[model samples]
Target: MSRALALVFTASFGAMWSFYLLLSVVPRYATSHGAGGIGAGGMTGALMGATVAAELAVPRLVGRFGYRSVLAVGLVLLGLPALALRAATSLPAIAGICVIRGMGLAVLFVAGSALVPAIAPPARRAAALGVYGLVVGVPAVIALPLGLWLAERVGYAIVFVLAGGAALGGLAALPGVPTRTRAHAGAEAGRGVVAALRSPALAWPSAVFSLSAMAAGAVVTFLPLAVARGSGGLAASALFAQAASTAGARWWAGHHGDRHGSAGLLLPAVLLAAVGLSALTLVGRPIAVVLGMLVLGAGFGVAQNASLALMFEHAPPRDYDAVSAVWNIAYDTGLALGGAGFGVLAARTGYPAAFGVAGALVAAALVPAWRDRAWLRPVPDAPHCPRGYR
Candidate 1:
């Protein structure tokens, strides 16, 4: 990796850690601050749904403004909500801030992902993205456990303030990167959002990305609660195990994807994830819960990195903004739906049934993996340009 990639990866680390910290704590914070069980979960789901809506709108924002400008705007937007969380005394106010925060997150992720393919060499794109995922994943693994710990030691308000400051730090790194505005100018002029949506390459990966994201969404929203039930107590240990396994898997798979093609890793990744989910059904002991979480996290890391790399591989360079937007929208929408639906289902049938259902859906993802070998053909002799123009 070059210095530029290292900087981007560092920025990603700050941004993701902040984002994950807030996501991990907000539900408990909401409940403690006044909102109850279902309402707290609902607010979390609303945050995710709002992000899906924001992702749908981000491409236009990036087109009109450049990527760096859009990134700056997202950072500002993200920071405000983190600060606002300190003052949110009611459910309605908290929900509103969640929406604002979600929009900011959506813009930041789409812009950042668009920048990744542009910066990486054609042959190294998957590997580069894998590293990017690993950087982001590390914080994700630690964020929840750390947040829970911080909330216990300090307060949620202080946690939000720290998270906001870290996000601002990520914004500070933006100015150092070389710009790609000139290269994207022609594509910006020629394409409309409708034309971008009509492309099969965009739609297919978006669908697959959405499906893969559902499992992760369920874990983020409900896994802690599930662990609590299985253990007859809540343990921070489960969060640590899940995060550690996920970060390790993401780093390993990213390097693997770079050495071998992403297609080579897809089937096994999904299969492992499905197996992990199935294991949840039989987890009656504390050790079993931790083992199940590790399996689940590893599977999610592989699927997430592989799927995103496949999308970039198949997409045209000029379409990076549109592709990132559409793919993220699919992912966020699935996340929201999975979180909300599983929350309700857990209330009805129980965690085991909910985990089983999510597992079944994940298992079905293999159908696409089998067909992806044909679907995601390698890019042929494409010119490598640092400016991101094809």
Candidate 2:
């Protein structure tokens, strides 16, 4: 990797570690503090809702402030408030902290993704993104489960302290990363998520990708709670398997998408998520639970890379920020909806049936995933088009 690209990855590592460490823990924390299932969902919803709200303005922020400034601010926002969680006893106070962190996550998502294509070679962009996935995904694999384990053994206060320190540590790499992407001037300066959504090419893939993200949100937020009581080890193991598989699948999908086509992978990716979620309906079986998560994680990973690579493949270099923002908005929006909606649904229907319904909902998205492949059909002689658009 180029030095600048390495620096971007380094900075992103800290942001992602802090985010994932608290992702599963925060909901559980709320539940422990007497918030109940709905309240747990509310905490996740608040964070993701704030993230979606922040995403809308990030393209403009990056356009005005540049990558380094926005990224630096993002690190602080994501890191600092996590420390305050140790003292927060009320649900509202915790939600307020989550909102600030969510805004920080929005900036990191947009700026971090936009910087990749700007710095990497066009022919190997997806391969480079695979590396980016590893950088981000490693945290989900390690910290996601580790935080839960640490919370059980060490206490939430220590987890909060570690999360804060991880993000603050990323600041040391900021000076090495570039302030602006090469295409950040002129026409690109005015483009935003609205413009990107107006284009069917970007919208279709984003819509398809959102479904998998929804499933992911539900799994991350409720799986531990849904498992048989006192099976905390099982929950942690299932999550670890999910994150590890996701990281591996994402890395593989990026390379494959670069060589073949990202669009073709979208259909299978959605189907896999559906199948995995369906398996979770058999929640009493430990083997089934782990296998289900693994399958689901694989699908989610492929969708992550395929949807993103497809979007970046079609967009002009100048529209990177807008495309990144729109993609991330779809992502976080699905996560918010899934986390909040599933909790309410599960409260009424029970976990098994809720898992079934969530699976069916993801399966319903197949229509869009299938249609997106046609919309993304390859165009000969177009430099921005991918071989797999067909």
Q: lDDT (CA) for every model shown?
A: 0.71, 0.89
Best-performing candidate as measured by lDDT: 2
- State the lDDT of candidate 1 residue by residue for 1-390, as single tens digits: 666666667666777877888875787787787764466667778888888888877777877777777777787777768887988888888889889888888987887777777777776777777778878888877786788778877988889998888787887687765455444856345244457667655565566656656666676666655665443234456667777777777767766666665655556666676677666675456776678778877876776776677666666677777777776787787777767777786677688877787788778866864665465555544453211222
Off by over 4 Å in 2: 186-190, 368-373, 385-390
lDDT of 2 by residue, 337-383 (tens): 88999999999999999999999988986775575567566444557
Off-target runs (Cα >4 Å) in candidate 1 are 33-37, 185-197, 229-235, 282-284, 365-373, 379-390
TM-score of each prediction:
0.88, 0.97
Clashes of each: 1, 1
Error of 2 at 268 (Å): 1.0
